[model samples]
Target: MDCQVIFQPSGRRGTVKKGSSLLEAARKLGVDIESPCGGTNCCGKCKVKIDEGYVDELSAETHISHVSQLTENEKNMLQPQEIRENYRLACCTQIEGDILVFVPEESRSTQQVVLETGKDRVLRVNPAVRNYFVEMIPASLEDHRDDSERLKAALLDRYSHLDKELSIDYTVLLSLPVIVRKGKWSVTATLWKEQVVVALEPGLVEATYGVAVDVGTTTVAAYLCDLTTGKVLQQDSMMNPQIRYGEDVLSRITYGMDDDNGLAILHQTIIEGINTLVTRLSKAAGINVEQVAEMVLVFNTAMHHIALNINPCYVGRSPFAPAVRKSLDIKARDLGIRIAAGGNIHCLPVEAGFVGPDNVAVLIAEEPHKQEKRRLLIDIGTNGEIDFGNKQRLLSTSCATGPALEGAQIKFGMRAAPGAIEKVRLDPVSLEPQYKVIGEADWFQPSQTIKAKGICGSGIIDIIAEMFKSGIIDPTGKFNMQQTSRRIRRDANNKPEYVLAWSEETSIGSDITVTQGDVREIQLAKAALYTGAKILMKKWGTDQVDSVTLAGAFGSYINKESALVIGLFPDCNLDNVVAVGNAAGDGAKIALLDKDKRVEAQEVADFVQFVETAVEPDFQPQFVQAMYFPHGKDTFPHVQHILDTIPTVKRSKLEAL
Candidate 1:
């Protein structure tokens, strides 16, 4: 018998044999389903809910079935409690007669991070879009001039500063005649940058909006703001759909170069994400998509090329440069952005090498150029970008720091999701560990009480710092053997590993341990971060930073103590180091609201002296020194003392209980 399968929301349908699984039917329909486990039902990602047609339509005894009964693996994977909520693993469930399935957002691999607003910024209200109410004479038989010409004459006469030719868009022109007749020769025209008319209404188009977009390699975020009022109406974010092709910029470049139409594929993926954000933002703000009249985009150099559909193969090579170094203003429709067709999209200035408009945006948002003391801005991610200077001088560089800090390339590593261990600390003498997972409110005092999933970046940093401070790991990050802690053991590869969560205490049904290799990834990442900062410091001729601000999602979550103990950056006053939040996104918002800030961003970009780390002398030695704790010194004594003295609140609470 043939079973009819219908996918919800999209309304795509296909027919399959009764024994065929839902995933097989979805594949036949060419739907995008994330089967990262390759249909093994391991990832627990292919989840769906049955809405209709599951039971026999003609049943005398009220029989119900959607497919075969749940498999043993599926039962174990999804707890019995979740099945009652209409959840089923798509890879394991089969289609029985005819049924309809709903794929929620969580089931999709293109799941997005929650959209976060940048640091609070108060923007000036002067915008490029202006509204003018024009009154024109009715075309009479004596005045044989056409309606369009008469309207243009009135605009020029009433507003002396108007261009001689106040041309309206063809589409707007077609509607202008009817609009004037309806309003009795009075129509509101939305003027863009003095030359062209964007929108027209019988009365006034009171609400015009614009979007500020931050194009991250992992996620893309959009903020919808009122152009005139400078009020942000709505914001949303999603995982860059390009993630399925590759994880990092280097991998994406290789993918784009190796495959035919690879550039187009990557380009379309980001476009799809931006358009999706637009749709969601408009709906959330109770406005039409056409109301959004402008956009400001900021991204890294690689993402910059891919979004513009330009080939970025050269950016991956030496003496790296982008297709363009200056800011660009293009029509939103020209780039397939479904806002107002004639609306403009403004991109900030691109710095030399891998630094793109994002660094410019960072400078604009931070305003370090106007500050008194010397300051440093560090954006940590796949590619760590650092900017240092005072009002007089500015220096910048980019480091290829890979994605290890974001929870990839480690055993039991995962995103900062529910159940992931986000904070950890080990006792100095007893060598006992206490931790907190992402979802649970209370700490895991007993490892068996809370099931450990995996470790994220902050947890990894804390674990290593605590391990080093407590003498469980030596200064070089090697696991100390003299302690003879039960939690320490050798893996199959004969590497010393420290188990944070034992097999019975973890969701993965195995020990969640940090191996020697995991420690090395952190060392390499921190070394890159330190070396870049050192290069800028040497250029500034100062070993001490007046202040440091960590910018970005990962940077915001990292504990300052852990960062210092790991030697991720040079030492300064502990209170001076602060996480400023996503400054790049904030800069994009600034540029979107005020055109003058775009000029300021350009000035910041021009003033910066780009230092190429690869060619700089003393980089290798600094990098090698950076690999050790506190640059292989006996520094961080205060940090070690803090670890020995101040215990976790969880530990204290458990002790009191």
Candidate 2:
């Protein structure tokens, strides 16, 4: 028997065999679901709601049976209230009959806010690929020269800078005779590095373009640029379709190591994603795909390996060695990229261990190596990349901060989107919260009828800081049980939580609250990040940095004060703390327009030293101390005055009571 299934919000419908898991149905129907554990049912991230009844598509009758009884694993993983609301783990639940399921925004992997634009700089327009229009004399009986030889001679005659031993792509050479004859011995040749002809056109084509891509774990962004003018023609971004396999690099690596076809699937998926971006960008810019002759890419080591179709199993193991550390120039056709047939794809050099070309890109964009004062650069994401350096030396490392800070592994958390709370401020006296949702221009008001869906990463940070400053929670991330307020109460599981939005103010028909578990998740995530920064500073033999730069999409939106309040990094002057949006993407764009910058990228990759924090003996203790609000022993000189204004209950006094 076959069961008809419909997933809401996306409205995707499909039929599957009876007793198939909901996760299997989602995969078959092309529905995006977060399964970071690779459908092992251990992560408990793939949650879906089942409607009580649905009308049968063929019989026109209401069917009540939808799913099998909840397994013992679901009973242990889900809260009591969630069970009552018909929430089931998609990996555990099996379809018994026709069903209508609703996947929550947090569970779905699409519609995320992807950051694409970055600070632009004046670039020296020396692109590796250039176009040259050459007019040659027709071949006569006396002048018996081969087509390839004649074309090379004519190119060197017109452009003295071109190499005398220029070569043509075999595919391009096959069509060269027909194209040159059709144009009456006049043609435009696209040469790569002024050495090899990658493409050819019938007439004098004046336009040339290239693409710069930033392949992130969660999102992929592409920039279409005019190689001649060094101007960005069009930009587009999309949620990385590979998220369906896993959310983090390690998970994907595990998937690859455990399954035979995992590496091939991941490689093909990213190629398809890039091809989709190329198609859209070319169409929007009114240019043919063949006209785009070059591409530059940047990503972390695991993503880099997956993009290049290399086995990443070793990248997740001890010592964490990458297959290659040097930059590569591969043919576009070899990678199945939908660009010019013989176009070249240039990948930036990668650093050792987990520090990859993306981190190197950050170094080039910020130029910390050129500054005299010590600088700390942090790119915050699921895996936080940290770099500390000055003119004398540079150090780099990666921290496994997990996905908690990005609204994962927390109750009532979601990505930045419409109806998601982005900012929050609580009153010190009443402990009442005022918030701003993503789609709204103003703070929440009583008369506005705003229905917040969930809290995003920035809002989660703000609320945690506000709770600490307002004395709602202690430094150890425990709810102040002695405080009396309507918003402060215990859940059905007897756990304390502070309500951010009442049931009437949310579309979920339930109150959104910050649970004790949520605070612990944030604490663990922040502690890992802070610990990594501390390790780098120790390696540099300094207690303070002259300046701090936050990079990435999430880092750009973080409130500096709130980040300090949570001890996301080591203490620094608030004035010196700056957020540079998408530095890695900026580095990719810079490399795309300038051929010299690509060489500089390789130099920077070799100059930086990678420190492995996992092997450090003091990591556990430092991580424990950093779990406290603003740290247990470290003094935050710049933000201490703000913390001093708030009154808090002493833990000893509460214990005595």
Candidate 3:
């Protein structure tokens, strides 16, 4: 049977099939609803009210909270209870018949994170900058003039209906005469705000071009964008060119400090990398290298300093200062950005030396602190950094979580690139294994195949959980080979290996294993994460947080239960976890589109209270204790309850203590 879906406020209308989930139908129609729990009937972010509808009320067994802070009219439309009603989570409700639904603005998804790859486009074509065609009635025998004078006369004569003031950059004026003469006294000028002449060509055009680059210590991602239309033209990513000198900022700073030419090389390497990406992406978009108009960069403090060849020695010392923590706009050639004639480059604002532009970008994108209840935004990478606050106050700190979680320092570690093992699941009947890789397909399906290379961040979480369950890792984090299964092999190199994929089936030459060193690295990573959480809870004067938001590349793919088993976060309610994918990238997108967001980013950066983790007194003890696999179930009640429900270990050697 056909069912009609009606929306409220203005009664905008749509249709759905009978017995369809309301959220599913809304999603099919390109409606936005915030379901941070991946539509698991949780998060309560997708709440909508049924204005006029015949629908069954949800059972008490539904996991989502029925009550909401919506208005009386909104509540009346939801399946109401005694104290509160009418608010139904979109994911939890099914449309059994005809219905009129009203989606709140907060519930509706805004500026979604569109999945991006080489070809995926992210924005519409109506750009902030546009090209216009202006036809001029050329000088007759009665009037005579040069091209510039004619152009100026035409602007003052024809566009005089408006406040027709024009300013041409000396750079574009070099080609203006030839362009005007070639177009037969008529031309298309790329004018920004109908004033500044950024470009001039022989004919009318549709769009302009720009590049957005995220400069990380390890990776650099570039997105070619159409400035006239604000669409992502092409994207390419590569390892940061500065890695030849060092992996961390301190090392790179030392490199620059020791050598006079170090800053120049660092600056040149990044520019060359960005220029290469711009050239490649521009070619893919069928555009010229010199036609690109602007390049925007977002990076950490040291990366920013190195990109501009600024001295970074003071950034590594006491008080941990930065040369400039505010956003800067400069000429591309001034910073050696090697772009086209009129290209300009903009850098996002920085927070502090340790907490830099990346963190500011994340905050600008997610706005987690907008909640009245406490929420923590953790961006874990080379240096573990976290932002904790609520609607009223905000605080930030950096932890030396190392690069452990990024699959560094561990014996069998790798990034989340193709062939990286990403998830692990035990076979219920055989007590054997099933796993998943990042790209293409799953390990369980016979037709789908992936040769396991090494474990990534998510896989590390699962492996840590499995070790705890197998009794191979004690609460103190000591590996006991005698207690583990025969499948769990030990190497002659004195490393304990948990065989995830065997040699015959794997892409690597030998069995893909998580080694003893890998386990230690994960433990250290977890220690940093948990210790930071503990410290923040102390500063806030309460442990009861409204929610925890994980932000970054790896945050979206992590398993909360596995994370808890590894002691990566404090024992909070599992329902409180929210994964905001690529918050930094989202922030970059916002900064790209909204000029006001740049100001907001600067405000957030200026206000974020930075806590230096290296100096905290309790940091070392908390780090040591948190390194252990959590054992006191009472102390971690929320985590323990989740672990209690998993299938029991079968093999004697693999059983937990």
True-structure RMSD, every candidate:
8.1, 2.5, 22.6
Clashing pairs in 1: 112-239
Give residue 334's error in model 3 in angstroms. 2.4
Best prediction by lDDT: 2
TM-score: which candidate is best? 2
What value does the lDDT take at residue 323 in candidate 2?
A: 97
Model 1 bad stretches (over 4 Å)? 1-115, 163-165, 178-184, 445-451, 633-657
Clashing pairs for predicted structure model 2, backbone only: none
Worst 10 residues of 1 by lDDT: 55-64
In the range 562-635, model 3's lDDT, one tens digit per residue, is 78676777766879887776566556655665556777788888777777665789878877888777622215
Q: Which stretches of candidate 2 lie over 4 Å from their true place?
A: 1-4, 17-20, 36-38, 52-54, 58-69, 96-99, 104-106, 446-450, 649-657
Ordering by TM-score = 2, 1, 3
- Number of clashes in model 3? 7
TM-score for each prediction? 0.81, 0.95, 0.72
lDDT of 1 at 531: 90
Query: Candidates sorted by lDDT, descending order?
Result: 2, 1, 3
Weakest 10 consecutive residues, lDDT, candidate 3?
A: 58-67
* CA lDDT scores, all candidates in order: 0.78, 0.87, 0.66
Off by over 4 Å in 3: 1-167, 191-196, 258-260, 427-431, 438-440, 444-450, 493-495, 631-634, 645-657
